[model samples]
Target: MATGFYTHPDCLLHDTGDGHPERAARLQAIEDQLIGSRIDIALQRETAPLASETALLRAHSAAHVAAMRACVPATGQAEIDADTFVGPHSWNAALRAAGAALAATDAVIDGHLDNAFCCVRPPGHHALREQAMGFCLFNNVAVAALHALEARHLARVAVIDFDVHHGNGTEAILAGDPRVLMCGFFQHPFYPFSGVPPLAPNMLNVPLAARSDGAAMREAVTREWLPRLRAFAPQMIFISAGFDAHRDDDLGNLGLVEADFAWLTRCIREVAAHSAQGRIVSCLEGGYALSALGRSVVAHVRELADL
Candidate 1:
């Protein structure tokens, strides 16, 4: 089966603001690259669905859910936090982002594809259970992970978050759950700095020092993340694939490039290949520099789709 590519037009409408790194053009850049390259793969293209409140509740609180919905502007934009904002189309876009992850999870579980990549926006790794912060509104990957176990009845899942910044929101939601093994490496002492002093046992956060390169990342994946995943033997693998760690991206100091992203995807895929029938669902997290993000993500999806 062809790998799935999950996305929505509404994702582009969730505008942050001028000068914002996570802007509409980021998605456009990706699409442009795909068309420009004419990359051949029987891509199972799927539109994102609006995630239900019940599904949102599975990963978030009623008040928190209501608050985010209420924040959607009628004709302009509403600021949710220091770095987060919502435009008129923010509600639906955020819904699609979270929903795309859920749909990808379902598709992977149903054997429609070996894996799926969610091209989403208003990124979710920074949004907490009750607080929307750091350019995030809803925890997309976490919501999908919860949906996979709670709704789809999967026993165990592993979420490998390789974003430049720590997935504080994902860690907060999935920390204590023994059903999920969360492993990732992020820049230390950065935004929403909480992964250093992790809260739970299932959370394997490898905080790399500033300026660490892709080689260091590979080592962390081999020495730290591999053991936990091998011992757990997850029924499915989920990746919070963020390309902002690329050398050209201004988001963090980690100096990884497109080749590094392809290599990382290969390693993560091996884990899935060995354990989960190659079932993997990866959601876009961060990658700001337009040119760099474009190349890095294409490299990632190319490997994920095995094109």
Candidate 2:
């Protein structure tokens, strides 16, 4: 079967404001590229469901949820942090972003699809359990990991984050849980610099220097992430797919390209095939440059779909 694709129109309606890097145009760029390349016809498409408060509580605090809801503006955008903002539609968009992750997990687990991709906006890896920061309002992948464990009755799961910045929120949420093994690579001394020491035993946080390229990433994966992931033997895999590491993106200096994203995706698939029954649910995290983000997503999804 084709890979499952989940998204929502509300995602595009989450307006960050003028000149914001994380804008609705990012998704449009991706869809335009897929349609231009005719890849959209080869995948299974579904509208994302709204994440319930119960599901949101799986990875977030009720206080946090209430606080974010309170921040929702009735007329214009309200800045939650120095970088994060919430418009009238931001709350629902965040819900749909996380909901897409949960829905994707259910689809993969129920045998409706082998793997799935959630192309929703307002990336989630940076949002902590109690605060929204770094352009993220909800921790989507964390919610999905918990869903696979608690709801789906899976004993073990893995989360792989390859964003340019560390997944501080994901680490905060699932760090000590033995049932979850989180592995990630991010540029050192980058935004939300907390992975340098790696707080949790279940985390395999590999920090690459600025300007490092895919060769360095390959080395990290082969030497660090793959071995740990194989030993963990996850029953399902969750990916915090972030494309800002691409060289063309000005967000960071990791120097990754479309080929690098594709290679890492293939590596993840190999590990999933070995241990996770080939089940993978990937969610978008970050990627600013429109062209690079679109191209990198196509490469990653193409590999995920094996098309």
Candidate 3:
């Protein structure tokens, strides 16, 4: 089981600020841990390209893309919302982040790799079609899923989001599309709060409480996610992988550890093997606490690599 690792130095250029939870150091921590654990050598390392305007437009409005480009400051950071910002190099970083997911989708589907993990920043699950929020710039996983459907011509696809926060942006963009099945468990009554009732039938979003533990998450996946995923039998699977749910992470109150992330990855991988020809593309989302984030990502990737 080959796993392609996609990233770029440009991703580290999206400086969110000194004390911001979503900073370049998050990617640095993951890379450091990958090297420390000797997982870096087993994966295929690739540079993420800049996403084309065509690809970005597939998931975002033209006005929103133009607005994001215009918001890039010449030197300092310009706030998109209270949480989202655009710095000098953020445009390129955002493009690369989205591009990584697109490329990974192509790689996995084309059989260059069995699966892939994109470790870029400016996470995209929160960005809406007409707006950017929740530290997200350009819905990377959403763009990739669209690319797989439109360009690659895949019949059906599944999106699995295990982020602590609801992927309201993804649901907003992908809802009601019969070709896609979106499933996930997120902390309810949390930031951007929008997953209780579900936007559409295709969206199987399970809302966990503030202090939910891994046992709760596991139960949700087993009872809610797995059955629908198997029934969908998608041609590919995309993961909006987030680690902020870790107990050590101050961002959210969920009590998941590295083992929990690995368990979740294994479950997703099993479903993919059974239905999607083992094609999986995972893109990073939210994870604040550095040490916990690094360990959790390594565990997730280890499962993806079957290591």
Number of backbone-clashing residue pairs for each candidate, in the order shown: 0, 0, 0
In lDDT terms, how accurate is model 1?
0.88
Residue lDDT tens for model 2, 1-307: 6699999999999989898999999999999888877789988998999998998999999999999889999978899888998899998999999999999999999999989999998899998899899999999999999989998899999999999999999999998999999999999998898897988899999999999999999998999998899999999999999999999999899999999999999999999999999999999989999999999999999999998
Which stretches of candidate 2 lie above 4 Å from their native place? none
Report the lDDT tens digits of candidate 3 across residue range 1-307.
4899999999999988778999999999999999999999999998999999999999999999999999999998899888888899999999999999999999888899999999999999999999999999999999999999999999999999988899999999999999999998889989888988999999998999999999998988899889999999999999999999999999889999999999999999999999999999999999999999999999999999999
The residue pairs found clashing in candidate 3 are none
TM-score of each: 0.98, 0.99, 0.99
Output the lDDT of residue 174, model 1.
91
Better of 1 and 3 by TM-score: 3
Better candidate number, 1 or 3, judged by lDDT: 3
Each model's Cα RMSD: 1.1, 0.7, 0.7
lDDT of each: 0.88, 0.93, 0.94
Q: What is the Å distance of residue 288 in model 2 from its true position?
A: 0.5
